[model samples]
Target: MRIPVPHWPSVAGRARADAGPLLLAAVVVAVVTLLAGAVPPLVSATADAAVRDAVRGSGADLQVHARMEADDGPGGSRARHPRLAEDVDDFRTRATDELGPGLRAVLRPPVATVISPTLKITDGSVLRTFQLAYLARDGGPAVSWIAGGPPEPTASETAQVPYGAPPWPVQVGLSEADAAALQLRPGARIPLADDQGNVKKAQVSGIFRPQDSADPAWRLVPALLSPVAGADGTGGTRFAGLLSRESLPDARLAFGQDELRRTVRFTPEPARLTWDAVPSVIAKVVALKAASGSSGARDGSLKWETGLDGVLRNVSAQVGAAFAQASVLLLTLLAVAVLVLLLAADLLVRRRAGALAAARQRGMSLPVIGGELLLESAVMALLATAAGLGLALAVAPGVSWQWTAPVVVTAVAAGPAFGTLTAARATRDRRVPANRSARRWLRNTARLRRAAVEAGVLLAATGAAVALYQRGVGGGVLPASAPALCAIAGALLLARALPVGTRLVLRRLLRSRRPLAVFGAARAAAASARVLPLLVLVTAAALASYALTLGAALGHATALGHATALGHATALGHATALGHATALGHATALGHATVDSPLASGLLRLTWVAAVTLPVLGLLGLALGTAAGAPERWQTLTRLRTLGLRPREARWVAAGELLPPVALAAVGGPLLGVLLARLTFGSLALPLLTGADFTPAPPWWALGLVAAVLLAAVAVVVPVESALRRRRRLSEVLRAGDT
Candidate 1:
């Protein structure tokens, strides 16, 4: 028996029929996508987590320390590289000879080193090394601290710094509460003599607060080993350190320097880098050494090459390859799904002979049927496109995702329109005797909706969601989100509503000229039954994600501006040059945090922050064009739509720029920042690529022209063809009815 979908023609019922179920479904899908999946990754990344745990014994994996003055520059200012301190002779043998294969052992060559600055001590008169300490006898003014076994000046210049003596060498934490005998803040300056028993001044750099981290708490008071200042006023005490992967100190040290490379091991396995990749890094460092070569370099210079634990390039490439394969497989899946939907639509349309005949007998216009059918095709295509996007969003954060939504939406939507046209080509015959086949299809509508039709819809949509989620969860592409479950349930209900949906819409919107629409509607309803909900849910997912992403970007930028400096750029510099490029992204030179409690925030200014205005403007222009293609296309469509005069369309399209203006002027730059931050995960910006500062102003104009021209050509050329074809159809059909 043919299924006749019930129509609710009353304005209220029709309204409900048209939009009711979809509204409910969107909420459900959102909820499901969230609760069923999200929150785990969020928890993992928060509250100070480590990707790898400690190797569980009281031994160090890698130790870090300053290279001696002869290798790096004197007094803790020079660069240093990490070297494996573990009796390399033994490990070297294990790697080359014994690592033959009893077990698959992987030792990735370490790439960079942590430079630990050193402190030297010298006194005022005898200006020896920085050694001043205290010795307590029968209380001859109570000897306080000892540096190299005697007392010394607590500060270099008395009135220069408002703050007292700078921090001491390796502090043995002392608290006044712990020792009520040492009533210690200001009046407790320890006196020193230059081997002449004369009083020399000494004040506390720290009176250990039990809570203060400065207190190492082993009891002996820390002595100021050197002068309070480095004489150059650089905060040689706190703001001194560099962590680099490729660059290193000039020479290797004796066995005592073992605690310098913090041995961090990757369990799933750290990828091994080849010796070849290090040459470029080695070259860059060599050039810097040459360009900024210190005359003091006559003492020594760095000479290095890639070793087992020195470069990560080879491992980085292998990981990228894995990601690339996953991307290819995903794209292939999308293309196959779109093709399947089109094929199904084609077969379904071919089978509906009576619907076409009835449409013709009723004198229902061709374009109306065509338009409605085409629109349904659009709906199908849109839904799938949306689903793909939904999948991407649902997968982002834990996984890297890249795509412009409108592009994906258009691709998916076009598939259906093309499919509809293909189906329409077969529906040319529109005359047939009305019989029980058409009448019966119009009769069993209720059961068709509740039973066979909805069953297939729910089954397919739910199955896809489950399968995708299972794969994602297991593979760790997507953590879990509450919205995921909502998305799935919403998709199911949307399908349940599809068979009767178009009929309800036509009954409400089509006047007398819609019989062909009605008949075509019946045919479209059943043919697309299994797929509708999935499509809608997917569409909602994509669009919702876009909205959420924009919000997230804005929020992130606001956060950076608030938490850090106003001129701060959020992108981390994986390499020195990349760090400089990231700085160029801003409009002006800004302060580097230089010191923060968190190591990530304490950055040394490598170069003066400067503008790359022309590049930035051009990039902005190109970005606008790329990001707003839909708006551009709409403007062009308005310029040449059938119903409107050119001026009228122009007015409508121009009005859209208002919101854009408002956003540019008053909208937070956070969205852009968030988007930029997201780029980090995808390996879109390499460590080296961020260094180009050659300003190209005129180049930006050329980019704008190219974008406008290309966008115009792609949109206009096809539209012109469509307009001419639509005009020709009008004359032929009286022609065909239209939207």
Candidate 2:
């Protein structure tokens, strides 16, 4: 005979009746998947942007220009020497070859020339001049000019002034001030001399003036040549002239070796490279220098200066470490979601246990019953997965295909699998004996199984802790996973201690003369079935407390580091002390922490957001779990009311039972969390938090806040139970038969 499969119509009808709990389970799954899909990319983009801003602001990617120094002899005497054109070219070529495609263009502006000139003006009065090179490469002389811009060079005129070699007969450019002082114009020939008194003739090819006297390029202009007699017969300094790069060779030849060596300053215009490519460029340069040393080749002292390598490494490490934390948090949320769903499934199964047992008695096979349950679970999972994906897309659009596919698969599979397993476990064919004592049931082997499971969890958590400690929080799952595992282990240990502690408290309450206390204690002592739910509730609250405390502590540390960094910046004159001081003072007054730099601010924000979000998620999970247990609470309250227990006494009984676990979690979770946070803080590569002198401390206020929130949540259970009691009729509740 073919076994008749359960029809879909019956399953659909049952699911419709149970829509409230099913919808809640679906929402929890949706939320967990949404976070899993969204956090990684958001974190990566934020880190990259912060690092880029920090590197760019510090000018770390700009190439430095240094004078070549030579060790003269066996005694190791060193002297500064002019960098030859060939030497610069060779270094550029090595840098390009070593760095490969990542290397962008290299600029080598011609050496600077110092010239002192005595110009014979049209009026026959003498004018003194000081001149230095003005090149066309990074927005030239005209770019800096405010009035009377530099003469535009023709194609042929530009071709004449080749790079690295200056043109003869010296083409020079003059600032408008210098030209006005001498009554000179473009193409006007002027006589110039070095400090050693050697003279040469040069034509002014351009005339320009600086927008600001203190413009960096203007500072390159040599100081006024020796003073000249003014029209009033008193000596006055002449304005400096801006010469073309083509004037360098002619000036060098005219001035001769000694005076040119003493006075002229040659600085290559800096090359700008991308922020990401800086570390690679530095590495290549170092390798080339090492190779050159081994080969006994002539080496130029190329002094590379930057904190960029450290900054980049730290950025990458911090991002990795933070993502690890996010992963752990995501996993915790998922675990909680799964547990809540399973509990909902178990509750649903228990409510229909009589129907399930009756169906079994009528020759319904386990496969048929399991199939119906699985089908219902599958429907819920499919709907939940769809809702989750939609929510994820809405919140974090452009999620990578890798993250999206896995999240979808996990959500689809997880709900149905867990729900089916829970239903199967709750719907066993054997009947529970009506005469089983509460204490005997509480001390049963199934209770031993729970203890074993807790032990296994504690062992696993210990292993994870060892692995995390070995890994040292550099940039991976350990940073996040360590805390999560510790929280779990701590929660389990706390759960194990609750029954014994509650019995002792109940015994003490039984001796009281007060009827409320005696009744509440008796009720709490007999409520053996509430152990698991109470354990879950306490664990969730504890996890939330721990997360908040850790986050607040990290935020405070980040703020302190930033404040210290800002103070250092002000002391070093990098920023105005008055402005920063005022801002910092205001922030302090407003009870907001401030960071000095962009990188620190980004890190601080990440910690603060995680801290706030994780606890809220834990609370949400707790609320769903509570909602699932409402029916049982209502039935229990109905039975109590029938035994002459008042609604006020019922509320007191609920509070008495819940307060122990909530109080335990509140005290234990933070202490364990604080310890975990202290251990994990060293792993994050935050500049401010990692140093010999850096000591991280817990945010005590945050711990207190978490305790208050948890206690309030526990307190809410009483009112909720009372509200649930008020809504149900005594007749209906009495007929409900111990649900």
Candidate 1 runs further than 4 Å off: 1-122, 125-492, 495-739
What's the residue-level lDDT of 369 in candidate 1?
48
Instruction: Kindly give the number of clashing pairs for every candidate.
Output: 72, 0
For candidate 1, report its TM-score.
0.29
- Candidate 1, residue 299: CA error in Å? 37
- After superposition, the stretches of candidate 2 with alpha carbons farther than 4 Å from their true spots are 1-6, 62-99, 105-131, 134-171, 176-205, 209-245, 251-311, 321-342, 352-397, 400-448, 526-532, 573-599, 624-633, 687-697, 727-731, 736-738
The number of clashing residue pairs in model 1 is 72
- Candidate 2 lDDT score relative to the true structure: 0.52
* TM-score for each of the candidates: 0.29, 0.71
Among these predictions, the greatest TM-score belongs to: 2
Winning model by lDDT: 2
Which digits, one per residue and each the tens of the lDDT, describe model 1 over residues 60-148?
12211122232233444322323322223233333233222311233322212222223232233222212222211111212232211
Minimum summed lDDT over a 10-residue window in model 1 is located at 602-611
